[model samples]
Target: MFTKRAFLTLLAICIGGGTAYAQSDPLPSWNDGAVKKSITEFVAKVTTQGGPDYVPPAERIAVFDNDGTLWCEQPIYFEAAFALDRVKAMAAQHLEWKQQQPFKAFLAGDKKALAEQGEKGLLTLVAAAHSGMTTDEFAKSVADWLATAKHPRFNRPYNDLIYQPMVELLAYLRANGFKTFIVSGGGVEFMRVWAEKAYGIPPEQVVGSSGVTQFRLDAAGKPSLLKTAKVQFIDDGPGKPAGINMIIGRRPILAFGNSDGDHQMLQWTMAGSGARFAGIVHHTDAAREYAYDRPSKIGQLDKAWEEAKAKGWTVVDMKQDWKKVFAFEP
Candidate 1:
């Protein structure tokens, strides 16, 4: 009973609406540029059925570096700050710390002395602070710290400082059938405490450095895992690839990171067969975020930066490529 002209108009409207919906932007936080185009195009090619570059859903593995890549790690790594705080909290019980070199310098706010202590000193602090507790207790402690600790410059909870564009990218990849995992140099226990809530990546999907732990049975017949001071693994640089191979058991098709620590991971991903994507989130926005490469002590991006450029990997200029850095930005 419908008029032919009216039927044609309804059909046109439906078609147009569907087209608009299909064209909606998945990475709204990213600016319209070559970088964005490359990302979208890569995704399209890899997802196209029967295409040469098409990757099966089960094989679409993506890995990301957590600190500085997904969130900020400046002034000092957040875990370092937590370790320092833990040292202060435990100082009263350990009188020997008053005479210890790094502890004494740290407690007295001697920056020069603390710097002299270097990596060894830092490890000592971490061991002192992170060990001697049950895994559940350690997790609760990390969660409690995250609930209260704020970044000095941003004055916001550390978890709240995650990159908006990267978060969107994660979701877009997941929507396209990519399984995301976080591969970081930070402590496995520390990252697992808040990563799921912050990045939509669950704890089991996180691969990171770890300290030794022992299973214990309490007098009440309660079985628990106790964290020990012994270092087990360091998931950085070459260790990144080793961790991926050991844990994931599958080479990632896509890998993203911010510094030299991720160099091996990027290299490993690119070495895989078929379509591969490697990206570096360059911290060029000093105003909205911290910026440093090579010279900086924390999150140095020297060798990896050069490699990314030479290999034609997407190196995102955070200041230019992202319209919004953080969700809190106006």
Candidate 2:
């Protein structure tokens, strides 16, 4: 059902034996297989002009869970490590924290003590370190730490361990007119500092858990939100979809994640009326990255992996599916 002009345009490119128009094919580094095929097909249908399956650019929204999907989330969550480091480094300012239960545990580098504190202790650490600073200061701290922090196993900067195939998929989707948004459990401010350079996703497009802040003029009298030790937002589980709806407005045509935290995000994306796609990056490559799934304390898979097959969702197995892990040679 092509109009005359549209038909002639594509036809001419085929005819003159000219270098053919790119078909938004195989996402460069992605292996030529089912995963790549599904991703390409989904993107092509949505972005092609005048096609019956075409969706307008405004509605061409894609949501991604940042940690395991875009990079590595093994051994522990990246932001959790950030919290632990912040507590130890800033302990000088608050000697009181050194005596506190979880803070003492964190300060001592006692993994067993930390485990004893569990979720409540983790929350205590997060609230303490993440709050009490301005947004700009928080972002700078994250950038500074990320620059120096090495993965315990890899001994490379955490940011450098980003998955190669996923990176290609992001760029490929963008070439097909999709706007990508990060819906992660990590702090929004933490990811915003490096997301643009790391993922080609702008700061405004990233969404994540956040703490409360208040307007306070610094010594320079510039307007800014100085952080407060209160939970303003927690963009995980059901909160992810709600955050996306509130912030991005458009429902996603595609969604990718690696944990149960993103279950709701996939739900929101697939709930879109037509041609929606959702996938999960299951960490099954211990050699290349880390072998982990449902049992892993940090990025637990459980329900996401179970529901993926039931829902016909593509599961990217790190060992079998991805031809390579980090784009840079490990």
Candidate 3:
């Protein structure tokens, strides 16, 4: 009974403007261009009553990828940068890692050495430093590190590298009754710990990769999940749809990402019968954020480029679309 026509009608019905009133500019800092237009149009459609493209408030599920979509991901992912730092800091305690391939590469102060290990090596490094601690412990460590670690280029806290446009988009969507979620390849616990503080998205709204975790009753008689080497979920590529299916249950009307890992997420969002939207945040502003796509090893923007065009997904070229990179980057 759920036909495309019914979905499209619902989409049209849910695109009406809500009762939100802005004292100043609704999106004051947003650049006056396609990013703003697309966002405004989407909001209007979803919030305007009697509009042909209106979508229901409850059905306005908009999911966004964390790294390059919401913030900078190069020269490498922020989490990867954290992982590298962790390897170096903990290297003193784990002397065995000093002789290891990726860890040795990490310890020797050569990023390329770990590159030689490729994906498997990177995963090994992530698991080694990221696991072995309770989820809260890992979160606290991340919070502690982010409090001091500065970007190599911008000399600002890693958390400060988030994109302003995306931030506005998140606020705008939520203001219009769109329930936003972060569906990323980054560790679920890793992002869940801080996303709410920074992006206003709660831990329950975040879905991402996670290593296996064991349930244990602690000294205080509390149950918690302990991180382990065993991979619980990858949460990338096709796994994105799987995660959304499992966690959210309902398909999203909109999805945003920046690389091949997000292709399946875009595909899944577009496949649903409705006024669905998919956008790829192309990293084309080296000055503002970063500009390496096909050649970049981490969060590479290759196939997603093709998929964006072929599927008619909105491709956000940072160089042209965004006037600002971060909230405080003035």
Candidate 4:
């Protein structure tokens, strides 16, 4: 019933609206807020050619923490859950574990007992579960676990719990010529197994704690690297900056994390010359996600929370800043 001019005018309006929508939101999962604004503005300033804060594409390194930042780390860490499952699976082989401190606690679902064992106990569990296997075998095990293991809360595959906004942010940064890397406290091998597929970050760009690996040839003349119980490096707290230096060889201009463990990395990133960005993903949504900070034993955010306020770093309130928590969420 419309005239040709009227139809053409409507088409033009529709096209213009689509174009604006496409150009406006690189991070669609993020809500319109100060946190989102800061991130976009920083990226824009650094990427604009010949701008005062312009940085070369080659130097646009962005580092992100894995647990509690890019994904959920609640009830228990995903890696720890994997290790505990491994313990249970291997319990038949090691009968003595029934009487062991951490093993017994893990087997009994005794959170109190397991916590008492502390970092030393956690390391013991990691060594027992992660070691004595070939690198390929370990990778396969992790892959298989990720494929089958469902989150206790969401009942979805663990990898599916990754934050949708963070995924968008990663893509946005990469699209703008930034190289993204995961700087985490989790085991390097464990994360490398699935990180590339989940985060679009290759294995080489992942910096994390590592265990010793020894190369050997089998009787059939097959060469393989065997994981050992000895810890080579721990990539948490102060170790984050050191790992970045040793592995990445350059300080990241942008860094994001969710815990006090990432405090040093944020510090190191902001300490760099020129325009830089540091942000913390504060877990403030108990309904959609976990809400814990100072009191929580896992992924504690006390010191970093205080420092973020003091230094004017962007602290993203998950409940407020994210339009969607996971891709699966309606």
Candidate 5:
């Protein structure tokens, strides 16, 4: 009983509305796969009122690893590269560094020699490079470094390497009444300087390996804390859950990570009584992003990868699960 013109106009409106509804996905960067479906379904079940899995808004805590999980940790950890640069910058001040073992090896670009020093050597590099500055000064130094530093392979600012799908996932979770925290192995003060801008997580919400700090009155009578070489805590592997317990005081209902370092955190989250979610971001996109696991020194995913399947954790294949990797196109 309608005119041909009216019928055509009605069809256009219906199609347009349908298209808008379809495109309103919160996690647009994630592909329509089981990985994405799992995240949404978990959030839905926990949030639905009167559902058996319903969680109070205050209990919806989610934790994420920073280095390889939120951003990139390929080739080497970004902070390690920063320490190397610091060594180069300070070489001029300490002429005797040329004779120092690890410093000499680092300055001469002899990576093989540096590797022989192992974790102890790397800690020495970090202590020499990162300490001897006040907390405020160190924070400023970190901000300055991040502003200019670029990933060697990507040739983009380090902050720009954040995974788009993961960013979307963070926002989506926050919108669903979840409190997100960054539990990283990187320095806590270093991450706090820019985490709010990078991941929308505040300084107090970041828990990472920390060094001892000494509070003293400066010449001007202003109180300041100077970072010392002594280590306070190392928040990786088993330390992750311990750090979460100490910092957050409550076990998270959901946890996301990328390497074996996160295995314990995921385990702790899964061990919780209520509805829980654990996810691992498997780095498989060799073309778009660097891929190395188990055999590699940095960000090894072997044990976690094996346990993920057994424990029913969502292992996100970067190449297949994500429609895109970095927020910016390669």
Candidate 6:
């Protein structure tokens, strides 16, 4: 027979042991499925000391695409929405915008017409909305936009739509010595303002599309960096790999993306020597999130989906693999 104190100690140990086991799951929002299994197994194999698949802490870099992989990007990209809002706000000053092709279409709420203008029209909108201001001014505008902008369907702030499983995965990877980065096709300065707070990735670790900037002195002789309309880097598709090479200087061991734009980045990551992990977040949950792939102009997943199948990369089925999508309750 055990004494009362000994019984209490045994009970405490059992409860503590159970709690430890329960809390061991790093990705609670991820269902117990192949996607979760593959991620955990890969981490375990790479992290094990003296194991064949062990990767050095210095080389443990993971790169993620921002728009559709980590966050929801349905209806239109968050950045695109921001540009439209900016166009509206500035339309008063530049009344000529109401008569222009792309701006006119966007202002008139003509989605089809805007899409017909294609990439050229989109760039025009971006340049008009993003340029002609100091970088500091641009940053402030972006911050202000993000503070008030809400997704159309969800009615929640864009940041709240970030995938919970991916967030957990990022944290888990960081805890295991992986340096995570956001390699987005969005504007560099725009993301730099909030990426750290939103994703735990510092501004220095973010590589994105950019416009040219030049140092200048204002009327008051205050030094400032002015954003220009000239195109600098696109940071999409082939440019994704180029941006990684130029900015990060190291090939990532792991890459996560959701569309064709991220194809080359995934290819570049897997082409490196050693064990690599490449994942594509397939948006299959129509009920929880919008599902679009081949025909969708925004975040199209067609080419990358086929490539992922051929290359044996992990394809995360959002509907089947995740117990929850957003971090917040609906």
The lDDT per prediction is 0.92, 0.85, 0.84, 0.93, 0.90, 0.90
TM-score of each: 0.92, 0.89, 0.87, 0.91, 0.92, 0.90
Q: Please estimate how well model 1 matches the true structure, expressed as its whole-model Cα lDDT.
A: 0.92
Give me the overall lDDT of model 2.
0.85
lDDT of 5: 0.90
lDDT of 5 by residue, 1-330 (tens): 799998887787676444444337878888998999999999999999999999998999999999889999978888888888887888899999899888888889899998898889888988887788899988888888888888898888888988888888888888889999999999999899988998889999999999999998988899999999999999999999999999999999999999999999999999989899999998888998977778878898989889999878999998999899897883
Q: Please rank every candidate by TM-score, starting with the best.
A: 1, 5, 4, 6, 2, 3
lDDT by residue (1-330, candidate 1, tens digit) is 899998887787676544434338888899999999989999999999999999999999999998899998998889988888888888999999989988999888999999999989888988999999999999988888888989999999988899999998998899899999999999989999988888899999999999999999999999999999999999999999999999999999999999999999999999999999999999889999977888988999999999888989999999999999999999
User: Candidate 5 — number of clashing residue pairs?
Assistant: 0
How large an RMSD does model 4 have?
4.2
Of the candidates shown, which would achieve the greatest lDDT relative to the real structure?
4
| lDDT tens digits, residue span 1-330, model 6 | 799998888688676534445357878889998889989998988899999999999889999999999888888888989987898888899889888999899889999999999999987987899999999999999988888988899988888888988988998898789999999998889889988888899999999999999999989999999999998999999999999999999999999999999999999999998789999999898999988788888899988889899989999999999999987754
- What TM-score does prediction 6 earn? 0.90
For model 5, state the Cα shift of residue 70 in Å. 0.6
lDDT of 4 at 25: 83
Q: Give the per-residue lDDT digits (tens) of candidate 2, residues 160-244.
A: 9898888878877786778989999888888898889989999999999888889988789889988888888899999999999
Overall local distance difference test of candidate 3: 0.84
Q: Per-candidate RMSD vs. true structure?
A: 4.3, 5.5, 8.5, 4.2, 5.1, 4.1
Error of 4 at 181 (Å): 0.1
Query: Which of candidates 3 and 5 is the stronger one according to TM-score?
Result: 5
lDDT of 3 by residue, 176-284 (tens): 8899999999989889777998898999999999888888998999988788889989899999999999999989999999999899999889898858788988888
Per-residue lDDT over 1-330 for candidate 4, one digit per residue giving the tens place of the 0 to 100 score: 799998888687676544445447878899998999999999999999989999998899999999999999998999999997887888999999999988999888899999899999987997899999999999998998998999999898999999999998998899899999999999999999988888999999999999999999999999999999998999999999999999999889999999999999999999999999999999999999899999999999999889999989999999999999999989
